[model samples]
Target: MHMVELKGVSKAFGDVDAVSNVDLTIREGEFVTLLGPSGSGKTTLLNLIAGMATPSAGRIEIRGRDVTHSSASERDLGMVFQNYALMPHMSVFENIAFPLRVRRLSRQEIERKVNDVLDLVQLPQIKDRKPRELSGGQQQRVALARCIVYNPALILLDEPLGALDKKLREYMQLEIRRVHAELGITMLNVTHDQDEALTMSDRIVLMNQGRIEQQDTPEQLYFRPKSVFAADFIGTANLVECEVSAVNGDRVRVTGAAGAFEVTEVEADVAVGDRVTSVIRPENVEVRAAGDDRESTGSDNPWIEAVVKDSLIVGGVVRHYLTIAGDVPVVAQQANSRSRLLLSHGDRVSLRWAQNDCRIIAC
Candidate 1:
């Protein structure tokens, strides 16, 4: 079933358009992320779904019920925010129990539900501690527990891990995923952090300038980006803008600042002398040094000459910045294996990738 659906949703703030016409659907029990850069309307869209803001136009349905005109309390939703929104004087148990108390549930039932969620969050031992007494992660866990205690139809997460340190944030990502899996609850998350979105989402709705730029699985958004923004936004993408020189069935030869190159993938109806951008992931390119006999760069092989402008070690990978064909920049990432030859600046290299590895976008 469609847990949450938006049809032609648009929100405007006077002269500014926070969210333009958008159509989206979140499946039952699915984790969907509204991923984008800052000021891209991800938060606004989330606010619209949360009923924190009214939409200028469109329809919203939750679990097949129209909720466009409903208030936040009328819609069954649990919200976890960046600030952790816990009452200072309230104990963990009280915090989780407060929602049930508002609903006028039985005292016995609130106790049962609060204990259950604390156990679910693996913090049953901290029920008596106040919000200030718990650590940041613990406090966030309390926020999540309070959210899930009522068994709301959907949970909304707005940068829930943003306040934690890097290590704690990473740990919380896994913890949240664990909680989601155990409860089988649908989650809608808003985040500008691409890694967070890519790591946690079942599907990503990438927003750009108040519009839905692309929506797809994380892998597809990274590897098969349909636009330059999607390619550059996800990860380390080496986009080579080339002018189409020739087309041979599925193969197309394009000349860019990096000179002429042939890729066996091209958009249909692409004619000669038209400009097209091709996306190649940095990790997908094989960086063989100019004189490396281990990999032959013969005429039949697909290879391009590049001069390494910079090289650095980033954890387990070595990133090399290369200047190809009149200063066109391309990045190549290689695993930091013991036997791997590490190149220095000014080292000439051959960058090669499979024809299928090149994603040619018409736009």
Candidate 2:
């Protein structure tokens, strides 16, 4: 049975619909992320699931029990917010034991659970310190420990790491994943950060304008997006407007500002004369000197002539921005290596990628 299920769930405020007819199922032990831009209904959906807000329509079930109208306190869920939400006057021990105390667990049980969770979060020694005395990361860990100490069936995190710096945020992502792996609890996380969603989620539900655009595993959503929004939102993609010129078996030829290109594994129902957009990731594109012999490349990859507009070495990879067919912009990312062709502004280069690396979505 699924840990959480939503059937046609929606929420509206006055005349604005925050979430609309959304259906989702999260299995036990799965880490699912609701990811999108602000006002895209991701957070609102999370709120509905947490019972902080009532849905205007539809039903919600937690472990097969309908809890659509249940109050937040009655739902038995653990939640972590953007702010630590710790009581400033309370010590870490008190904060972590709050839920257990609320349930009227014996003092001994509360102490045992609190100590275990603090150790699990690797901050057992700081139990006597108040929230104000701890670092931001430590405070966040205390909040997480408090959530897990109660042994709730579901945990909801709303931008829980939003307050941390980039480096600390990245560290917390790994830390959260470790905790989830150890506990095997169902987690529903809300965030507008795509990188965090990709790094932590077993599955991601990409939402937009009050509805789910796509839900799939990280690799599937990144490599096989079904819509333009999905392609653009998940990562950096070069979406070129084109028209289908011909179709040969699984390959389709498209003509656009970048010139003629062939795409394989056409999943969308596209045919000749149909307008489409070619979605290709920057890393999938390969760059070479324009003067290199085409035949010598020894591949059927379709090549486009472009002039290097800019280049930046980002750590271990070089990002090359180019102009194709005048105003059309394209980017290629290549590993920084000895044999990589170096290109500068105004340098002419040939860009090519495997036919399978590109996908088409009907415009």
What are the lDDT figures for the candidates, one per model? 0.89, 0.92
Q: How accurate is candidate 2 locally (lDDT)?
A: 0.92
Q: What is the Å distance of residue 309 in model 1 from its true position?
A: 1.6
Residue 95 in candidate 1, Cα distance off native in Å: 0.7
Model 1 clash pairs? none
The sequence of per-residue lDDT tens digits that candidate 2 reaches over residues 1-363 is: 999999999899999999999999999999999999999998889999999899999999999999999998878789999999999999999999888888999988888889899999999898999999999999999999999998999999999999999999999999999999999989999999999999999999999999999999999999899899999999999988999999988889988897887888575888799999889899998887877876524336667788999999988988999988957999999899887778899999888878889999987
* Model 2 lDDT at residue 280: 88
The TM-score measured for candidate 2 stands at 0.97
Clashing pairs in 2: none
Q: Candidate 1 on 1-363: residue-level lDDT in tens?
A: 899999999999999999999999999999999999999998899999999998999999999999999999988999999999999998889999999999999988998899988899999898999999999999999999999999998999999999999899989999999999999999999999999989898999999999999999998888777788988899978888888898888888877876676787554468998888988888888888766756534423357889999888899988888988878898988888896657888999888777777777786
